[model samples]
Target: MSTVYLVGAGPGDPGMLTLKAKEVIETCDVMIYDYLANADFLKWCKEDCEILYVGKKGGDHTLPQDKINELIIEKARTGKTICRLKGGDPYVFGRGGEEAEELVEAGIDFEVVPGITAGVAAPAYAGIPVTHRDHTTSVCFITGHEDPTKEKSGHNWSVYGQSNSTLVFYMGVKNLPMIAENLMKNGRAADTPVALVRWGTRCEQTSMVSTLENVAEDAAERGFKAPSIIVVGGVCSLHDKLGWFEKKPLLGQGVVVTRAREQASGMVKTMRDLGACVYEFPTISINPLENADEVEEHALQLGRWDWVIFTSVNGVKHFWQHLRNAGLDARQFGGINVAAIGPATANALRDRGINPDFVPKKYVAEHVVKGLLDLDIAGKKVLIPRARVAREILPAELTRAKCDVKVLPVYETTLAEESGAEIEKALEEGRIQYVTFTSSSTVENFFQLVKAEKVQDCPHVKMACIGPVTAKTLRDYGLTPDIQPEDYTIPGLVQSILDDK
Candidate 1:
């Protein structure tokens, strides 16, 4: 028999997703997710997993409540594990109880996985703790969208207004006036602090603060829309002093990363951690060389080379892959001196128990050639394992030093097939503040996707290049990079952006 797991997706932040929720999503055979849930979480699902969108937002119902319940029951009967992914805590205004009741009635087994509700998390991200000891000890979560014309109101405004507790309302922006009026009429102070957090917990989170008396008017003037959380209490006043998320240097800034998807994670994390809304636009995709025979053949004869050079981390990785495939290990290159172009490439070599003998201070072809020249490679046999297409300056310069240079193409880079719509839209809307290029290929491919003619559409979008080579590529397209780190690495690029801010 298959079991149904009703999992909570947490507020809007993908990081808030529980480990259990991720595990369930990875193992589930089918998933029915809500619209409010961050779709990024779906990446955890198996490629062949059956997914259903039963999300309901306002009146835009993808599937009615009754129909969703039936769908869950029917999917569970297929003897496959089903995941009902809901936004926020499963039982907290998610109608998870209703679904559970139906499953029980149908004699189906089910498990509930609670998640972080938006009420608590949204306020915390906005820097207002729900339960500050100096402020209020009690906190209440309420739905502001409750029907006002119902015969019997579901909430007791009289009790809530008199209680010394923080009040948090979900989906409350539209009914702000009525909610404030009812609270004041029931003895709540009109001067009480109120804050509305929009798109809370995500990169675009913003909060507006006001008193109960004029919060509705303030929100209207600011054009605060739905999908916002309203917090009413003394805790709302603490936001200014405690607001940390929005204070990040790149908090509201949108950045586009043009590295390959597999290599973009580190840069993406760095930018996101600094509070920038990062959009990954992989312009170049890395693939292993079609024929690894040369790489494998050279790996077996590694002892013949006096110096082995790696220009990029991908070179180190692909080289090791082929070396391992040929039943060779680091021992094969025991006497061979290793030279890495940069710290990242050197670190990649070190990770596999090979410490590079030379890592140039500057990560460029000229620096690599200059550093190798100082190492007396005059009569040496140098083996360079790198991408299929790269600057020939390193090998040409090394060969001029009387060294026998042998180049092995271990990997290749190709332009990504898909043009990223999200990145293009963000750029067109002038929402993207920075466009990062990690390599010459990335710069070329990115310009191909976002034509040079349209580059003027986003005049405010600054260019960031990882190194001088990438910056030169941008210059070739009639664009000058605004941010270029002195260190020429991902961390350096991120620090340069932060330093500029």
Candidate 2:
């Protein structure tokens, strides 16, 4: 906790993480985070960093405030950098100010990093602006329930009720009746518009609207709990008209994305955009090939081949790395035609100073072969720079066509490790609704870590494969894919899942 960084984990989306917060997280020696902090942030920590969970949810505190403060002081004495991460803004009813006072009393150096709080963000996500020129000019933020440890309450209902302002209450679900009564008794209108938004900014975000006179009763009937933001004003009336939340087909659904780690970010965002809680489980780890000299030697003799085929971006990247290491560039390819399996691979080739001569509409072995053979490569020498263990259909087909084909290994995919027990627990707890496979390797590697019976036992959990090839791999393991797109692409796969739901 030496020079502790009191950082804020923004309202739900990992994409909202600040540049400085990301830098601190990546370099911090210890991460003292809470439940509201995105679990994805943990993956950014260094392998050797120590992590402590001090989550406080509803009345369930994993570690009490006294113990957490003591733990931070103890760790700070060791001169290790500590990231004291909290949900939303540390100063926005998050008890961050209290913690900072304690740190100051202990003479610990600290820095505060602000975040997007639920107060402002939740209303916006629900299509209710806290301030409107026609409605109110000012806004008031109050804790629905004050600290019980205090000798007296700090709320002045008389002045607050008399003011013409928007009222927002944090953690107000349980105290909604008391708050409504206090405001009404102090001269505020009982029939004012009010909205309750729970788990704001997340895929599980839900909101209900009513007047202050009836919101509490309605919330009780609906069983809305704490951790909800209560917005009371004319702005609440805008929710029904401006909100598009109901259109999200995958809302509150949990999706597990299994792909190579480096390639899964965009996929994760896409799944979340569909209003699903994404669990990024990167089953495959892409690394350089063990045979560096073999790849380098092949790079020096590219002129011997009539065509060079790159099946994936990894192939293009790894092959180009060796080509540069051998003091050769794309200009060295004097007479060799370049072929890419998909647009992504073609883009990767173009990034490295080579424009692919041929790219198929469908990214499959058969389609690639059909497109290449259309260009008349009979009896030609072909070199494929690709994964160490890949489907041999392309090479085998060319060999059958009386062409010399050499499959050169450029990169390899290995299994990435995570807590299998935790994953099983998430599935058992009904937090996971879908498991996605983007490639054959991802499907194979996922089964290697997770038991087939665990997946089979969860009737609610559906398997989603990107295309027919990946689905075939899942079928080989005796599991049928519940969702597969006819277009055989990432966007199409996601759309198919939404359509199925």
Candidate 3:
């Protein structure tokens, strides 16, 4: 029989999840998640795993506490590895104790994986230390949500108000006025600094600072909502000097990445680290050609060619694979001069122990042709390994220079049929601030998935292309790119977005 794991999903950021929690999630056969848990974590689950949402938001409950407990027990009886994923530390006012007790009574084996509570993490992300030697030496976590079953209040407001410990309230937005009034009436200073961090630890995090006397008013004025952490103490005064997360240039900006799934990680990490909520909507998928026999045949005849040019990283990778499959290695290229279209393509070749003799200053077909012209290969036999469908300018220009060129297909790029629900919703709500295109293929396929009319309707949504080639592709669809970096690289594109803001 499988065990039921009660896991805590830390705050709102997936990066905060513990390694043990991630392990259990990845191996679990069933996942029952809460509303506050980041949905991004679900991507770690197995393909066939069953996901059930038993989230509770405000007064609305998708499934009552009793029902949730029963569901857990029922799932455990089926002998499947079940993960009951909750938000924050399950024992820190998360009602995890009740679930554990029920599991014990039901004779089910279970384990608890503790997580970082939002009360501490949220304040820290907002630059407010829960405990400091110069401020308070201790900290306390409290629930602002009152218990209806209790005949009287269990909390001693006077003791809490007079204590030297820093106070953190969970789910306190609705009762902010009452909590503040009680604290002040019981001896806490009305001028005490307080900070409210909403959507804490995530890219959309925002913190508001106010005095205890006017925190409720300030929160209302600024439109702060639930799923927020409230910190009340002298440490809150340090928010301005120590505040960092919200100050990120693209903190709340939403960007859509149209790179292939395998190639999207670097760009995703780059954008996300800069505090942009990245939506990976890959419009193209790169795959090796159906038959690499021709590529393998050409690779075996590498010594016969005077020049071998790789147009992309994909070309280098696919061609290298074919070379190795044909019982050959980089040593076979010793008699041939190699050229790469860009530094990335050159680096790929270098990784395979074959450094290119030429890398064009400009990453384009025309520049590749110009660079090859300077090589003085008028009668040289050249081989070009690249995508199945691409511009013929390079090969045509080389042929015009009196060189015999053989164009070999090493890989192919095709449109990826991915669900557009998330992108559509983001566009409909005007939440997508930028759509980034890394290549002409990404630009063309992106327009295929998302109609040009819909993109034009979202006034807040702007287009960002990696270089002039991609920008030209956007222009072909009658759409002008709002941001294009001078460097024409991933980092450059991100910098352009930051600069535009």
Q: Candidate 3 — which pairs collide?
A: none
The digit string of per-residue lDDT tens for model 3 on 402-470 reads 899999999999999787777988899878899999999998898888888888888788999998888
lDDT of each: 0.90, 0.87, 0.90
Candidate 3 Cα RMSD after full superposition onto the native fold (Å): 1.7
lDDT of 2 by residue, 388-428 (tens): 99999999988887889999999888899765676788899
User: Over all chains combined, what TM-score does candidate 3 have?
Assistant: 0.96
Q: What are the TM-scores, per candidate, against the unseen true structure? A: 0.95, 0.95, 0.96
What is the per-residue lDDT of model 1 for residues 1-501, given as tens digits with 9 covering 90 to 100? 989999999998888999999999999999999988888888789999999999778658899899999999999999999999999998998899999999999999999999999999999999999899998999999998875568987989998889879999988788899999999999899999999999899898999899999999999999999789999999999999999888888998998888888888888888888888888788988999888998999999999999999999999999999988998889997888999888888999999999999999998888778877888887799999999999898899888888999999999999998675667777787788998888888988987887776666667889999988889989999998899999998889889989888
Q: Which stretches of candidate 3 lie over 4 Å from their true place?
A: none
lDDT of 1 at 374: 87
Candidate 2, run of 10 with poorest lDDT: 417-426
Residue 372, candidate 3: alpha-carbon lDDT: 80
